[model samples]
Target: MEISDSKKRIEELIEQLNKFAYEYYALDNPSISDKEYDKLYDELTILEKETGYILSYSPTQRVGDGILSQFSKYIHKGRLWSLDKAQSFEEIIEWHNRNVKAVMQYNKENADKLPPLEYVITKKFDGLTLNCTYDNDGIMIKAATRGTGEIGEDITAQAKTIKALPLKVDHKGLFEIHGEAIMTKEAFDAYNEKAEVKLKNLRNGAAGALRNLNLKETAKRNLSAFFYDVGYNEGDPFESYIDMMKFIREKNFPIDDYMKIARDTEDIKNEIEYINSIRADLNYDIDGIVIVINDMRTRAVLGYTIKFPKWAIAYKFEAEETTTELLDVEWNVGRSGRVSPTALLEPVDLGGVTVKRATLNNMDDIKRKNVKIGNRVFVRRSNDVIPEIMGVAEELENAREIIAPSNCPSCGSELMLVGAHYFCENTLSCKPQMVKSIVHFGSREAMNIEGFSEKTAEQLYEKVDLKTLSDLYKLKKEELLNLEKFGDKKAQNLLDAIEKSKECELASFIYALGIPNVGKKTAKDLCKNLKSLEGIKKATYEDLLAIEDIGEIVAKCIIEFFSDEKILRSIDELLAVGVSPSYEETLVNDQSSFMDKTVVVTGTLKNFSRTEIKDKLEALGAKVSGTVSKKTDYVIAGEAAGSKYDKAISLGIKILSEEEFLAMI
Candidate 1:
């Protein structure tokens, strides 16, 4: 009722609620029920409204944080490029109304014989949205992050290493394929354990993984990919939208599996809701659902805005909120033994999953969040990535005290202050340390043992004396399936994967070693100079330092690799298990002059029209754009001369009239 009292209540609510969040959302362990948490969340909301106690820290105030990071800038296939973000059912209906109106404006006779504006809706993945370009021969020419839809960094070399990314496609002509780069839930958790940082929420996790400068770490993360569609195909040869996706998939592109064909907008909306309901269980990441008219001709007629295609719209799911009470804060130790303080809370249901605990981040975060025990908090899930403690409602400042731990809870090791991270130097001996090490070794990037996940690997190592990668090769399938959640199917997949990975190259094998500072590139360089894994055993620090990008710290880590008994034995054991490190020479970089160019662009194009213009311009190499520019060498304007026409004339830039476009052709 009073201001101070309201503040106290809000603070108390924050603490109680955040504890529940930390337990349920972040930890995947819930201690309470949904009904109970929601009641408290409601009470906080009602009290705040009635008491006029608008605490800035109110749980209801904090909505979702940033979703995707800044996309790279690039040329759009069309001049108008803006994406649709649907936050509610009403918004979707509004979009639907607009889209239907756009279609109605078309000729009825043209529409009658045609397939009802076929709409294909696929689950929107919550990962790094990437664009891959392929030549007619199916050879991947370039891979890029979706920069502002205009220009993107050339990540061809890095992209090639992702096993899931298709190196060659069956489809011909210039096509822009779009998809998500991700780490599966199984792999992400295991990696987060070893990296000792709470895995970023999935989308963030995947983005962070993709953008990491060290390709070895990226590879080590076992980043998987899923290709959705050929975003653009200049030829218009594919008569049907389904055919285009099929062509993409036939070429072994990773398409989202949770796709369904819907008959109408109603079906689309229902399907979207259904997909959102099952998103938590799905592997990889999904944020919303994308609906696009299946008719390519209709799509062309429909066209698009600067952001989103007119025929395609994304029905983003709303923030599913649940309430919980913060019971206590627990100091958690990661593989790094960073003492991250977690809020242990009462259980709450979010997105159908029972959530009780959530991440309080760190002590600084705890203080900043100001959520203490006895506070009520609400947590929201964004695309199954991670949950955040939005805010505290009806707090109780003095209700209870939650503080950081002075020592590692997993082990008795004293936690020393190291930057924001609390480090415990206990290696291999600490339970979390030992568990994470075993898990990392068996991780997909390393030995890629199938049945081995972070939890399974930890239990196997501790219970069966599974100490190293060698120990894993020795584990019997029967012995593994006997563990928790290890069914016959999973066990077989794991064993089969392990058997298949018995033969590996120097880069992968070196990456599996878990040595700091040595990644895929460093490993490749090490092998390039040494020629064999065994050569690393005999190489001096000076030899390692001679290689570029290999610093003293990395050289020391490599030099110590031979001296460390466990690492040395791990390599030998892998060799014994028939995992040989084969080395290969790296390819020279490709430098086609037409690679970078900038120019105004527009209109319906013929021939490799866009692609050929791109190729030739790229060859003689020029950059083509949708909009005309001031320094435009050639305004390659096709049909429908619009604003660019006036702009070009005013600028006095040379305009390649359709006649001129044909002449150039």
Candidate 2:
């Protein structure tokens, strides 16, 4: 075929494949079989290569070239503000009354210059918020997280993997669209079935997929996005949000049909009640309902607060609860060596999903609740995400008392009581603890070992001499192939991931160490303060206490952790095996005002959001803490500073206003 003919054919094929992908992945209805789609895709790819003519909107361009070294921050065209939450009907009424008073006074003053006020209520999706930007050419240039409202992590490549999201739209002239990236129940279960490590919840599933640098893995999650608001657009602005919704719908964007306009507070309340009744029947999870002023004029008049819009509010629903028979209690060991009880039950449908198990917390909780095996228990699911056993509902006459295990199930070691929980002190020998630790070490937020799985950890532990964490670095492809279900591609991929993890950042390496009570945030704080792993190891308890949020207990834990001879040996082994942890150079500042200071930000600030201020503090070589403590050097108080300000004042910590903070910086 001629090049001209090939180009025409490729364009047609690309269009057809895009439609097919949308139908299959987004609409959940496949018009074409996978084989046929693949055939067409292959044909188009070959034609593009042969003719040297590739369409920007081609299906092949959906997957990016390779993994990004690190995600770059993208400044949003406009700030993305959060919504104030209203938990009760009374709070909603109070907000409605305030709106009524404002609109009434405005109409009285201007003699009805503004149109009648109305509200639009839609379900609040419990998923990751994404901002998609389309340039003047109608080409999607970027998709970002709602990082700090003003700036976000660019995930354009990962966003393209969402088949529901349009790679190229018909009309774009600098449009910034807001949407929620969510994973459906079907996709979540399907992924969990094949995945070695299961996703805990749908929210995390969507968030994790987008945050992952690997576009291929992001595609595997089958994320779907529903666009709602036009945050920024150079085109003629819509008179009302409803008109904007119509425009978005015309552009073939995914918008839920559940958006309802309410004329009054009663209408709003009724709509909310209707939403609550059908929430269980919905495909995706929603934590609450968002009520916003529909008219652009009214929204402008109402304006916005520093952090949240005054014209909008979120009404959160109560936690979903159900009762089921507790058949047994299964104890699991965590990376921190803590042994926790999980209640295995007769499957009971709750909030559209069947929950067969729930976290029983600890032995103290079980004993306090008088929980027993074979007893019907009340299980509560928070936001349709985490399941927890609330208490026993019905006690069976034959119910057996739940007894705490005297010995660790994985290592046969003696169980010791630590505060309210039981722990297996044998962290090195316990299979569950060791395996979990290895898995955590290789987790996406930690060492980020690509393709790492619990099954791989189990195989390495049982079959190979993978006794210590250092043994992971010592793994060979040949030995991995000896394990069951191992393939050449899989083994090589894992090995490459292991090698890549050796060059991880200092914060991730510290987090991967699985230190007790040390999370990602704490690890970052430690790294920012200590500057290196060596500094952390050599730091005394007093030195650790100087860091933000590091109290006497946490300080003691850090000192104890580094004091362990085994941990030192493991560190030496890792270093010997060529593992190198790296840290970025400190940011240059005109004045190092906040250097070596521990700062906490409270309430809404005029210049920066909570996250942005924290990042700024960290960038300025200061440790930004979450709480007000005795170690805190300064507290940046914004409008409505609330209890943190009170606590800081009580503790005699220095307080700085937003202007004062800016001046200091």
Candidate 3:
């Protein structure tokens, strides 16, 4: 019950909960009842309320409601779309009402009166959705799902075998099809029982089924699909949802009989109510109700929201149940030296992934979660990102008192609170902070020093009187060779790699300096105009503020870096040691056609990532915005075009579709 023992207890509970999540969600074969799971969840929830512990990965924080396969990276032909969630009934109704108005507005000019239209409501299966592309020959060429709604996975080899998918579609030239890949309850149980690492739920099973190496292997699983709609087509394939269903059925798709086409809000409500009532009885997974417009053309005009389609909405089903024990809380410092705390739970399985640590943003967050050692807490991980301690469960006031850390554990420096972080004012002198800076400098993205691993850096510091990173360049090859276990070959490689990096760009050098808040991209921008180390040193804070992405924090870091006599002396010493003080900027013609225009770079490029391209373009004085807009003179499209591509075309704005964008770059 002691606070010191809390870390160990939380780790244990995390393991247990992770196992439970694996059984319940990923495997879909629960050994315990829903009520039992809730009991465990309730216990943890109560503890979180008192102790303020939040593990980064908690079962309660996860979305997908279950485990999904580690999604394979695929170059999508079109960008995968993310859906906008509706939290309240009013929000859902308001969304529909707006869509109805928009659809009417679009058709108003053509006719005297708007046609009376009703939406078709169907079950929204909880399983991941896939967009399978079929050639006219009926061969499955590509398979993707809505990943950020821009680009999706290329699961062609895996999609080739999903049973409901036909070898060929009835009408296909270049056609894009949509469907939900799902695992049935029986198959989920059987797999959980037989498999070495049991899938936690049917969703996981479906995902696993998709990633299977062999078509035969995928076929071995009882996976099914309900072909939704053909998003892309050379021509009209079906007039209505009913017609589309019949077409897919004729083509050998396994359409679920429960798919009822409900027209009118009353009918939609009735269907949603019915799905919710019998949700537990269904053989396949149904997360909620999916409402779509029967008219494909009309659906197109309705367009989409930032994340989801504005034309339709999903009414989600309530989550089943879960539980876990709260044990302790821990705190970690980030790159900016911000101390963030996390809740430690007794081991728990979430969506097939082990959950242990959840974030407690700060002292305020700790109070919000109210977590404590030896108390029960409810937790959830959302969007597979950070988990939150939702609430506390049963109380254990008899346990030893829990207390937050007063000093930084790594340096034993007294902690000072700043915003949401507990800071150690000794940024330059803190041992942990010092080594972390050195590691950042030697990183591939920062300095590109291949042989300068963290282990070597640490060892060098201990073996010699190394105070700063500049000393690394001063180490003689023979001196390194004489070090423990380091022979001539390894030492020589390290020396050569270090020598090769001396000629690195000014931006990379800036990033390597380990200045606070100066990220890679920002560093690149700093050098784009300044071009030399001395230029940065000479520039005023006002001068730095002129550059894009150089906010107040970054500007402050830049000013401080140049002002520090130690940092300045270190750089002067590095240049004296044959390092590039500043590299000459590549001469690029400013008269280029795209100059002065705002652009957005998206999707996977054959040559460069969006970041790389953005860095390169900024170096040339071109503005690249993250989001697409009217000001977006060009959107450099890559393999998969997402909503941005559609948005650009709709606005009658010029677009450098991925291929064209690549050529321009």
Name the candidate that leads on lDDT. Answer: 2
Per-model TM values vs. the true structure: 0.42, 0.51, 0.50
The candidate maximizing TM-score is 2
Q: lDDT per residue, candidate 2, 1-665, as tens digits? A: 98788888987897788778766754455788899999998898889888889877788888744777899999999788999999888999999899988988898898646777788888899889999998897778889999999999999889888877877777847899999999988899899778766565677789999999877788889888888899999999899988999988777677765677888879988877777866665667788899989889889898988889999999997646768999998888887888888889899887667889899888766776788999988786754566888677899999998788998877889999989889998977788888888899899989999988999899888899688888999998899999988899989999999998899889888888888888888888798788988999999988899997889888888898999998999888988888899877667463688888899888789989775687788778787777676678999999866556766875678999999989877
> What is the Å distance of residue 49 in model 1 from its true position?
72
State, as a TM-score between 0 and 1, how close model 3 is to the true structure. 0.50
lDDT of 1 at 540: 86
> Local distance difference test, per candidate?
0.66, 0.84, 0.67
Worst 10 residues of 2 by lDDT: 21-30
C-alpha displacement of 558 in model 3, angstroms? 3.3
User: Better model by lDDT, 2 or 3?
Assistant: 2
Give per-residue CA lDDT, model 3, range 1-665, as digits (tens).
Answer: 66545555554554466556544543234677878877776665555544567453333332122333555765555444555656556666776778677767877766544345667767777777888776766555668865655567666555544434554444556777678888888887776566555454577678877766555556556566777676666655666666776676665555554565655666776676666655665667776777777766676667776666666777765554235776776767654566667777777776446778776567765554455677776665543576666556666775343466888876678988766568876665565566677788878887788877667766676676566777878879777876777998999988888888888878888888877777877777788767778888888988899987688888887888789887788888888888884666666658766678788776667878666787667656678787665557777777655546655765577877656755565
Number of clashing residue pairs in every model? 74, 0, 81
Candidate ordering by TM-score (highest first):
2, 3, 1
lDDT of 1 by residue, 1-665 (tens): 77788767866775565555444532334577888777777877877777777543344543322233333445535232435777777786777777666667775646444455667777777678778777776666667777666766555445554555655444557778887787787787787667634453566667776666555565556667777676677656777778887776666665654456776668877787667655665656666788777887777887766667777777776545556888887776665456676667787777667776787776655555566789887676655666767556568656666666677787788879876667776765677776776676667666666656777867776677775667667778888767888788887887787777777767677877767667665766687678887788888888888887788888887787679876666677778877766877543223533234466656666554654555355444455566554546667677654456555775577777556655553
Error of 3 at 146 (Å): 27
